[model samples]
Target: MASVAFGYLPILLFLLVALGLSTAFVVLPMIVSRFTGAHQPNPEKLSEYECGFPAFEDSRAQFDVRFYLVAILFIVFDLEAAFLFPWAVSLDSTGWAGWTGMMVFLAELGLGLAYAWKKGALEWE
Candidate 1:
């Protein structure tokens, strides 16, 4: 058991060194920047501006529903594609099980798209 434990000593040492180096890399820059950087503050420095337009607006202003609909659709499709990556990588080994699983997943995504379309979520007018 002692020999087995000794065999892993190098790996344990490497992990500790790696962790220490990573921490130092992150901390050193932060410490240096804090000491050397300018500590200046002004009202205009914090204001948000885009193309010379005032960026802030009334907090209670109503937003167009289409914007939210498009965002939701984007998230749904993006997640669906995210799942496809792992399935694609193991395609050769997964055989029919993977194919059927992906088919089901695609079918569900298609249903969601269809629902969104029928509900006028896709219409921009």
Candidate 2:
């Protein structure tokens, strides 16, 4: 049992080192900046800068929800590609069952996309 557990020692050590390095990189700069950086704030510096001009309109402009819908649609389809890779790699091992499973998954995705398309989610207007 101890020997089995010891087998993971290198992985554990590598993970610890990776975490330590990542933490040091993130925290060291902030710590150094705390001492070396200037600490002064004014309304001019705090005010929003837009296109090298002062704000003429309300910053919180209402945008169409279609932009977000398009983004979400892209993500849903993009994740389909991610799922395809493992399915393709294990195609032979999984045999007909795997093929059928992937078909069903793809069919579900197709149905969802079709539903979205029908609802004008894909339309710009």
Give all candidates' CA lDDT scores: 0.91, 0.91
Model 1, C-alpha of 113: deviation from truth (Å): 1.2
Clash counts for the predictions, in order: 0, 0
Per-candidate TM vs. native? 0.60, 0.56
- Which pairs in model 2 have colliding backbones? none
lDDT over C-alpha atoms for residue 49 of model 2: 77
Top-TM-score candidate index: 1
- Per-residue lDDT tens digits for candidate 2, residues 14-113, read 9999999999999988888678874346788777776776777786987789998999999999999999999999998999999999999999999999
lDDT of 1 by residue, 1-125 (tens): 99999999999999999999999999988888678874345778766665675756797888998999899899999999999999999999999999999999999999999999999999997
